[model samples]
Target: MPGARSGGSGGDGSNSGSYSGDASGAVTVWEVVSLLGKLLGTVVALKVVLYLLRVCLAMAWKSGGASHSELIHNLRKNGIIKTDKVFEVMLATDRSHYAKCNPYMDSPQSIESLVFNSFS
Candidate 1:
């Protein structure tokens, strides 16, 4: 009652409802709904921005080459493949031979499925 503002009954035979007090004291129903909508919109906007940022970073990390030598060259240029021996080894081992999908991408690939054989 202290923070509530009650509206008189309208001519439409409907009683005007009262809203509860919020952190900013007494607030209307429309104000609460608007605030909730704004909060949800902000959250969704942030999620979309984050998703775009992740996609951009992934694209940046991608070597953009369809060959093992090019992939290794990109890795060495990016300083991931530090030494010559490591670069040679990586270049010698073709990812396409092992990875079935997106082998040239700078990410982990599931080369094969693990089969656990239990001995009774």
Candidate 2:
């Protein structure tokens, strides 16, 4: 045949070049390893972010205030609370709006005396 190779000769009449047995530009082992490393790093970073978020939420819960009240409500959904009165009162009253600066902090806030005097 016109394009056929002779015995022990390259089909194109060239030296067949380096690694000529497989020359389809296949991915190298290093490239595969690098890709896996990048993927693993990304997964690890995502897990770290998720863990940080959980930590922040836990801190918020312990610190109390509006978020603490909401956490209590969520716990009640799972039957953690024996009654709904506490949740209902917390829902009816927004301590953050009623207080100043970090309204959610667990502490007694003073109300304006004028409002209190009105009740007198």
Candidate 3:
């Protein structure tokens, strides 16, 4: 009777089974929310994984860095990592290196040898 129904009257047969419209810009809104959710989750997960990897690598590379002892402490804070192997790595460093806590300590043949010899 009127030019068009207020609700677009699907049951009245005036309109098709479905409504035709982009629908008040809601499509864009929903897409933006979904994309933001996924992007945020991905970023958070990546940060956590990268942090764990960093800790693992710090466990390996500390002896070559300036703060070898501090790196051992950080690993301890993360969890129960074996300090003995890392200590051996520090021990195996060259004589001129300043990271060694003890200036008088002898440089071991290798980290492998130091670990074996210590436990033996």
Query: How does each model score on TM-score?
Result: 0.43, 0.36, 0.32
lDDT for residue 56 in candidate 3, whole number 0-100 = 75
lDDT of 1 by residue, 30-52 (tens): 98999999999999999999999
Error of 1 at 53 (Å): 14
Minimum summed lDDT over a 10-residue window in model 3 is located at 99-108
Flag regions of model 3 displaced more than 4 Å.
1-26, 60-120
* Model 2 per-residue lDDT at 56: 65
What digit string (tens of lDDT, one per residue) describes model 3 on residues 17-55? 364546463556777899999999999999999999877
Model 3, C-alpha of 16: deviation from truth (Å): 14
Residue pairs in collision within model 2: 65-104
Q: Can you tell me which runs of candidate 1 are displaced by over 4 Å?
A: 1-60, 114-120
Q: Provide the clashing-pair count of each candidate structure.
A: 0, 1, 0
User: Over the stretch 20-58, how does candidate 2's per-residue lDDT look in tens digits?
Assistant: 544577888888999999999999999999999876655
